[model samples]
Target chain A: MSEQPTHHGDRPGSPPDGRPDGRPDSRAGGSSAEQPAVTASPSRPATSYRTLRLGAGPEWSSGQLALGAVSTGGAALFLVALYFAAGGFDLIWWLLVLVPVLTLSMAGSGMSLGFWALMLYGWFLLTDSGSFTWWSLPAAAGLLVSHAATALSASMPPAGQLASAAVHRWGRLIGIAFSAAAVVCCAAAAIHGRSLGLGPAAYVIGLVGLAAGVWLVRTNPPSQPH
Target chain B: MVSQRRRTTTERSLGDWHPTAAHARAVILASVCGVAAVLGRRPDLLVIAAPLAVAAGWGHLARPRAAVTGRAALGDATLREGGVTTLVVHADPPVRQADGVVTLASTAWVERKPASGIARLDDDGVAVLGLRSLRWGRHRVGTLSLTLTSAWGAFRVGPTDLPDLDICALPLPSAFDTSAPTPHPRGIVGQNRSSHPGSGTEFNTIRRFHPGDRLRRIHWPVSLRTGDLHVTSTFSDEDAHVFLLVDAYSDLGPREGIDGRPTSLDVTVRAAGAISEHFLRANDRLSLRTVGAADVAPIGVGSGNHHLRRVLDTLASIAPATERRDEGEHAIRGVDPMALCLVLSPLIEPTMVALAHTLASRGLTVIVVDTFPEHLVANPANVHESLAWRIRLLSRAAQVHSLTSRGVPVVPWRGPGSLDHVLRDIARRASAPRMSRR
Candidate 1:
């Protein structure tokens, strides 16, 4: 039993003679004179027992580091594909790449949404309109990979190892999500260089099409991979 | 066989699931990109936004609405020093798609497995964390907090805290044995030899057989040689009372647990336990009284395994330096007069030395077992502390010398055979005749 920090009469602030107060020391006398009149109290309160904060913060497990790498790598791949597709680089592009890498630990936050929006805005502004590029397919894949990896990384603690079952399940879900992107990319390519020429109704039709896409995406049930 | 003991708590509600930051991020990005793609007439943008839309939709659709509840349990509530146990945390109605992480806080004298104290729940929502108790005493195991994240990290349940569990760690007694007899053997049913002759295993002498002597004790060879009836006489077996007076005024040295160097209190408690176990096993009645620690209740004279457990429990309950004003009057008030008194202390406090002198003055056989840990002064943190220890030790030596001058033996604790020589000498002195003035 180590000397736990004690309260009451035995505290360090007690008199030098080992007495609680400035009372006279009677221990030098016979045993009969040594007894002191003091009120008995409980040794310590129940709430005093508390956990100790030891060591530094927990280190990231290998699984967590791997997920983080994948997230950063996917975001970088997307930026590189976008740069090549646009055939130019800007100062904002460098900032966009740095944001994802720097905020990789906060992948679960709204910062992820903000970064994705900026990346999409860059692609829209830089790429030629009314033209389909093969780079779009790989760039879409990169963006989806980044999103999936960030979500997975945020699901567990830094020290928590990713279970093989969970890894497999997430992999399958990413595949399904990317397959949707592939389908959309193929449809967009098929309609390249063609115009239906529906006139003023195209705006109303596009609005209806956007609403339908939201509904279709929102109503789709998640799969159980286990 | 040692049966396993477990304590399980009732399930507690963790409230309803809420959307995680990931879910909000996905839904917002997907919605904004979809509208932008349609308005800007960029089909390529729509293709890039497709995956985000799918992820947001799938996560929303798969979000579990049922409220979650969690419970934690311990594999064993009591353990010996250096014993290992398991803590299991469970989330009711296991969510297969959700990722669960259980974190156990770091506590004193407890070594957690995986070093991080974090364990992941399997498909059944069960997480097991290993706990190894390093010292003996009543200890509260670390608090366990559980967190659950829904599929695709869309939603989360909680980082809900569970109730803390308690473990009673019993001290591991050091090896101790004594072949010498106690000073006063006054009761029946023990292995000690009494002065009066009677039927026993220890032979006394051959004597003329009395009418009540059993035939089995008759010495036939002696009877034939003398042509008279003779019997083999033996000393009667009797039990003695052993009283243990423990000093808990201060616990010196670092608390390194059972695996490391012991503090003064650690040495005292374990030595008391070893002594109790030894005497109790020999069928001698034993009593335990603690001076400084108020929490420890005095254990009365008893024998057998049950009494040993009671003794150890009392020793385990010692909280050092709790009662600074203790005069040891209550501890020694009604002690058995003939009981062999063994005072276990570090002799750092004047109160214990006074108590020892008082007990010896009452004509009781008192032996002070010095429990001062040598490692305390071995490598002091500074020269001042080292000098302080040197001065204290000199004073302590004077106290020991005073006790010895009064015919009370002060012995330093060394695991086995520590008290054998002193006990043998005490027994011899007890048997010797003494002259007194008429």
Candidate 2:
């Protein structure tokens, strides 16, 4: 039951001593008689009994904490790959690294989206444009793991433990996504430093692919009842 | 307007496969990086974005199209205190590859199995949450809110609110029994010995045969010795009328529910239940009436297991101090004159004491069971509270003294064998001659 701080005079019909008959009050509702008054200090305000307490935050299960750790680790791995690609560590890396670790609790939120964007932007800015590095494979793995973990975390409450079936299903999907990245990395490495001299066709194909991707992700509008 | 907007948002979300933040993140990153790889001629970006694109595509393909609906049902609507029941949530046409979370809100005296009250749906899209009722009363089970996430957390459905269910928790009566017979067993059907002679198991006296006496009661040895027809007389078995008058005026002390120390009302109700059970099991007619609570229908005099259930139900319905203006005139208006009145109260309220006096004045054998919890005064929080309690208890003692002076026995309830000595005294008094004004 929610605790309500009851005073001697709180009840409407009851008298000051908690007696209904206007008699000098007794300890009826366990309410004490006139309490000894305390003077409030000048430096601090007196505490109000009516102040609402929101209680403690939601407790996280071990499974959820482990998943959060995995997400943070994945983001860290991506940053590490970026550092190796850049051939040096910058002070900005610390701020970038803190984003994923700090937002670990809210992995389901858009904050994670911002974290991924920053990591990918860093990779693009630090690495050479034309050359394909093998580090991209591990970086891709890291990004996928983080994304998968975040999705799983968002599916349930912090206190909810992931079921074994859900874990297996997500693990399988993650493997499939990483395999696709590996295939693409191998294809990119094969065509490195070699030009097939196909003019505006590549750009046209890329635009068509982008349009198709947009259509695939587009949500259908709610149907109106006739 | 806020609620309307929330409803609209919920409807829109449930109506279609809306993208989750994860889906948006994947799709946006894939499109941006894929475009950047082609536009800026960056092969490494394409390699990095490939996995995201595949994930986005896979999630979109696996998105659930059918609208899902959920409903929750309790395993049992009526349970005894401390009984466990399951809150099973069913999702119709179970959506495969979807993750579902059902959250049961925390309610007083209702303990959830996981403590967090969050249960993940099994593969079959059904979630079962265990609820243990710790106290006796009618309680609305916690609001069950369900949310379903499509595969890859790509699309979402409800954080939908399902209809609430109610569970009637009946009090588990404390162990009670008494070998002493109830006073004034007047009705025909029971196990108690009646004053009038008739067909029964208990021997009364040998006398001349009456015309209405059964042939089996005729005694051959008595007839031969007297040289006249005589028959064995046995006391008739009759049931007693027990009127349980529960005082619902004040529920003192902390409401810690059934697992902890009981408050005044808890003690009173449980004691009434135990007494009713004991009497009804012995074929005694029992009726129950509450003095101060509202909406508690008075149980009429009845016997057997069915009536015992009715008595328990009435006891469970009591909400303390809901009707403070009650003078208890209605509670005592139509009580059986021969009934033994058991007024269960902590005597915190003067109204109960007054009611007990009224019952005793009507010449009914009234016993006031003091249901006061002694721990209320023990280990007081402060000196003022303790002193205040001591003064209150002195006033309460005067009330008990008044009732005792008027020949109403006030006994403190102590579970099993609590009423034995008092009942024996009342029965003994019933046999003794006393002066009465005509």
Clashes of each: 0, 1
DockQ of every candidate:
0.17, 0.19
Task: Locate the minimum summed-lDDT window of 10 residues in model 1 chain B.
Answer: B1-10
The Cα local distance difference test for each model comes to 0.76, 0.76
Q: Please, what are the lDDT tens digits per residue for candidate 1 over residues A44-82?
A: 212111122224534566677688778778888888889
Q: Give each candidate's interface RMSD in Å.
A: 14.8, 14.6
Kindly list the per-residue Cα lDDT of model 2 for residues B76-142, writing each as its tens digit.
6665565556677777668898998888788987867555677888778788776667777777777
Please give the RMSD to the true structure for each candidate, in Å.
11.7, 12.1
Model 2, A1-226: lDDT tens digits are 1333322221111111212342211211211131111111111121212211124545666567678878888888888777777776687785665666567567667888887887888888888877678888888888988898888888787767667888999998899989998899889889888987878987898789798977767764321111
True interface contacts reproduced by each model, as a fraction?
0.35, 0.42
Question: Which segments of model 1 are wrong by more than 4 Å?
Answer: A1-58, A195-226, B1-11, B196-200, B205-236, B380-383, B436-438
Best by DockQ: 2
What's the true lDDT of residue B195 in model 2?
86
